[model samples]
Target: MTSPQPTPAPGRVGSAIGWSYVVTAGRIGSSVIVTFLLAKLLGPSEFGLLAMATVFILFAQTLIQQGLVAAIVQRDKLTAEHLDAAFVVLVLAGLGVGLLTAAVSPLWALINRAPDLTEVCLALSPLVLVQGLSIVPEAILRRELQFRSIAIRTLLASVLSGVVGLALALGGAGIWALVGQQLVNAVAGLVVLWLVCPWRPSRRPKLGAIRELWAFSAHAANAGLGSLISSKADILFTGIFFGPVATGIYRLAARLPDMLVDVTVRSIQQVSLSSLSRLQQDRARFAAHLVQLQHLGAVAGLPVLGVLAATARPLVEFLGPQWAGTEIPLQLLCVFGAVNVFGVLLGPALQAIGQPGKLAAILWSRGLLGVATLAAVGALITSDDPVGQATAVAVAGIAIQLTVNAASIWVTVHRVARASIGRFLAPTGPAVLAALAASLVPFATDRLGVDELGPLARLLVVGAAAGLVAAAVLWSTDRPLRQLVTPRLMRLRRTRAATGTPAGAHSVEASATRSTEK
Candidate 1:
């Protein structure tokens, strides 16, 4: 298979951004629908059981995938032999993980005291295999920045999974429905990746061809494992100490923030990973690009997370009374989400700069800190107040984790590119301030009885209003962010009229030209 090229044009980037918006919307919508259906079909107990199983499966998958697909996107040259070797590695790892999951299914079932989980685990095992096969092809597509195709594939997978899951639930399949949905989604995703992506695995494997790749992969795996442990330790503790009902409630509270994080951080990571990889040879240029990305993420991320944190109570109530206890946890988790924007952007930087070992070390440090925090919190809080304990654990862990992550990324950037912390944080400060200011309006509105509005109306009014206000505030306070994001918005009417393209597209064209020339 041939290596995928960079995005064809600035218009292509815009198009990809548009498609990403659509794909994100689709994923969020599907998640809300699925969650609602499952909540109604199965009570908190069963939902929590499924959530526990899923957390394990997802963490395991992340470990096995080893961030190599990300490595491939960051690497400049992708030979046929490299592709072949990566595919071989993925296949082997996938098969091994699948078999291991299958073998452990009975033991997990016994430990959890849920016989039904044995079937769920066994049925979901194929997902690892399917995902392993699809990783390289999906990476190739991402490298090409052909997110429209990816969006289409994702939509199909979501629909198939939703339909299959709902059907199974209607048929009284219990937790099997959730497991079936995930497996089916994996299969669909693999099929779509195969069909849309041009890469095909070769008949022969080239082990030696991927030595450097394996080194990167190993570091990435270690980092990913650390990240996984850090992120999931709270949930694991909840499952162990508080039982499935509490775990399920906590999961529900976390759902919205998690969805937003996935949509924003994950999408940006895809773009940054590919773009930064191309500029890796130039330390100065790469650092500039990294800062630009960090600023963009802040501009986009802070306002959204701020609003969610501010309105968590209303949001929980609107979702359902069953979700009422999730309000505080959601609010607390949003802090992590805000800090995570910085840490997540650094991942691509590390990959691009060929410093996966440093990334691994940072992740391990954060993970160890997170584990210690969780353990300490669990011991301190009584079992009668599991939610409070979980929240405390999450907040404490995230605080330490973010501190370590920020320091590590700062050190790496300064050492590698002679960058300073002030340069990195300056652009984001104004936007963060703007978002904070906008959040006050919503808090006041909630205090003044506007929150009594219907759920849908409240969401629309508060969300839309806060978004507009925050955008305006940022535009006024942060000239660079405004120029970087929507330069056309600041341009004179005459200039906009002179351009045939929308002022926005015109600005994008100009920016792209400048970028290319540089």
Candidate 2:
């Protein structure tokens, strides 16, 4: 048997992270625009209906993707036969999920006590199919580290989706406007992926060739179930106990933190999975990379989560008066956000080290804890007060989830990555302390006199002040962050000198690295 040759360690991690930031910024900007317009056009009830529809669509989409894309990305070798079989399986699964969603829409509406939810779910069913088709092509781009292309495609889709949704809502389409927006985004994304990705299905499927792939994907499916539960448990609980209006508030409140976490941590995971997969056989190199990633997670995540936690009230109030109830839930969720960043990074590390089952184990434990916490909280809160119930449930679940996720990542880092406890805790502990100190600026300001400021002005002041303080603190105390951010800045200077396009330098470097490796 021939040993797997070591894959090249492309210098694209930084570039990938940059592209992710740019893409995330564009999406966030577009989201803010769409959200403001939607809130003006639609009332809380309509927004709630749209939020509920999205939860169902997201749940189905998660199941259909099932981490198979990551599995494919981590593989040492890729072939046309493998991509074909994966696509075939995904399409079949998408069809099944779509059918199941349609079949169960009425049941869901009945259970949730929302008669209109059935129509909303039925309207959103095609999204599952669209997402399933898009997954493989997007995975192919990610596997090849074509983040620039991915970023461009995502920006276009976000723009189109937002524009269409806003137009429809202004034209009095109500919740259907939201549904149409999602379908448009999905279809547009699939079209872009098909156009940008060069891969095409072969003439025939090779079932035997994909069996090992399925073995990997089966474990991924287990992990993905846990991931889905972790991601959606709060929304599900809110919808069940607090109703659609409360869910809408929770959804919007959680949006900023979720976007930041996903953009920062998941972007790293994308590059890490491909990069670390290349270093799988070198235990020393793999361990070193894991350490660097742990620090990276803390340096990037802690301050962001802290700032959000500190300024959540102002942020929520500024968004709208209806959003004020979201403050506590958003703050409590920041702890989970910080812990989840580490857990997410570790899962990719396990997969890169050829331990997909370990990732599955960790996620399963997390999901179980999350569900139990939610159930217990629900049992305790029988009140008709939606915001109160939602707050209690969110606080309890996030606390349990933070504990469970932290323990899981620690174990994975120690057992799978073979790192010591001290090493594991060192970077994160200090970063958290530094973040807390930096976060106090906003908290103290809110306590002192800033409370009198109007919500909009207060939110802007707190957000800007918190950002500047956090950056200064991070640059002063966090050497790793300085190192990481500094090199990229220098590279921009060099690229500007050479090509006179500082903006395009990172993407150019990324493309060059991928080409050299190929």
Candidate 3:
């Protein structure tokens, strides 16, 4: 048995955040390249097939990877037995999930009336096992605050997998390019994780260890399952009703917002969960820290999503004419993404405070609401036009989701944590104002005849205008952010002067490697 480590120091926490952003940036860049290339090469039908198979992969991976790995991170104390037991459980779960997916692939395809998807699903089944193998190790790295290693693994895997996918696409491999990309990413990431992480699981599974972890992990898994259902419901409905082409269009529309959330919101959530969990026992610190993170999320995440929504038309047009129908849905989804920026923290905050059951309840409620609303929208919005149907459904779905997320945030911040609602929401005013002010830039550009420019040129000009406006507004109004940034800049300058050496990626990676080795 080992005693729990203390909370991470500010410097370590800062490094964790930096590396997390590095990983996020790398993934976003690679994803943008690979995704557009494949979309252009294979067209809508192929992507729709990939999306269908991915739905199953996402669900199954959540089952195997979410619960126990989260338990390991949230637990106050951990031992070799716990790690070993979690690893064994994940491995077994992965094997079972992969086999089940393979067996059910045909049935799923049959249900969807897409015979081609059967093979696609089968091809992607092994991802469950490959991805599962890395979960515990990845969790261990997170728990240890070894984000630099994780960053490296992530960047490397993304780049390599993007190359593979691109090469296959260029070779006219169709949807298999997408399929191969996922598998290679999972496998490459797993290999890098094993290489970087020092912990090796022994072949021992203890019932006691599993039970101790299950106390938290069960709820964590349930909450994750619910969240997944909520997130994936729109895709499910679109695919089933509108077929692959419509599904593909809707999927692309959702993709940018989803990627923005992943890059901004989820990355922050990952770092925050670890930090918040460490501060759980200190009430004042915990509450203050939570609110500050909310402020950060609003200031940082909201503006980016707003800009994306504002520039959605030009951005989607740049993708190709095949994506002509994506603009409205993308804009709607960006609004959902904005709501997520504010509400996403509620889950992690609850989880950190040892209220997994509460989080689970909130998420399940959201999931139910999401499903019901999406179903109603799907049924009510009868149209021969797929794009129109998708837009209608998106409007309805995003509206309901916004309400649910707002309520969830209220429960977590106002009711459970007993934080001041005004204080929790203080930053949002400036954030929304800034986001709105920034959004006007793209509209102004359009008014100035920027629409006559090429899609890429319009995107660049509009994106730049929005970004500059957002930055200026935030810099002017977000005092807390300014306060946070000034000190960091000062510290960096002082450190640079003291060392007379640049502190860059190589240095961060090297230091992290040394720390890992030691």
Off by over 4 Å in 2: 1-6, 40-44, 446-448, 483-518
lDDT of 3 by residue, 131-173 (tens): 6788889999888878889999999999999999999999989
Higher-scoring candidate on lDDT, 1 or 3: 3
Give the distance in Å from residue 493's predicted Cα in candidate 2 to where it truly belongs.
Answer: 7.5
List candidate 1 segments past 4 Å from native.
1-22, 40-42, 109-116, 167-174, 485-518
Residue 413 alpha-carbon offset, candidate 1, angstroms: 2.8
Candidate 2 vs candidate 3, lDDT winner: 3
Of models 1 and 3, which has the larger TM-score?
Answer: 3
Estimate, for each residue in 1-518, the C-alpha lDDT of model 2 and write its tens digit: 02343564556665665676667667767876787678656655677777777778788988888778877887777777778888888889899999999899898888778999999999888888887788888888877778888888888999999999998998989888888888888788788878888888777888566786777888887888777777677777778766787777667656667776776666566677877888888877777777776676677678877777777877767666655577877776776676677666777788888888877777777777878888777777878765676578667766876787667767667777787767766767656775676567775786778889998788777877777777777778766556555766787888788888856535544532332232
Rank list by TM-score: 3, 2, 1
Please give each candidate's TM-score: 0.88, 0.90, 0.93
Cα deviation in Å at residue 203, candidate 1? 2.4
Q: Highest lDDT, which number?
A: 3
Report the lDDT tens digits of candidate 1 across residue range 1-518: 34555534545554554556567668777977887777667655667777778766776588568878866776666787888888888888889988898898888777656676677777777877887888888887877777778988898999899899899999998877877788888888788878888777779877787786776788888878877887787777677666677777777766766777667666666666777776677888788877876776677678788777766766666666655577777777777777777777887788777888887777787778777776777667675764675576567756786788677767666776568877988888877876677677676677877787987677767777777777778888987754554643555456767775555444333443332222
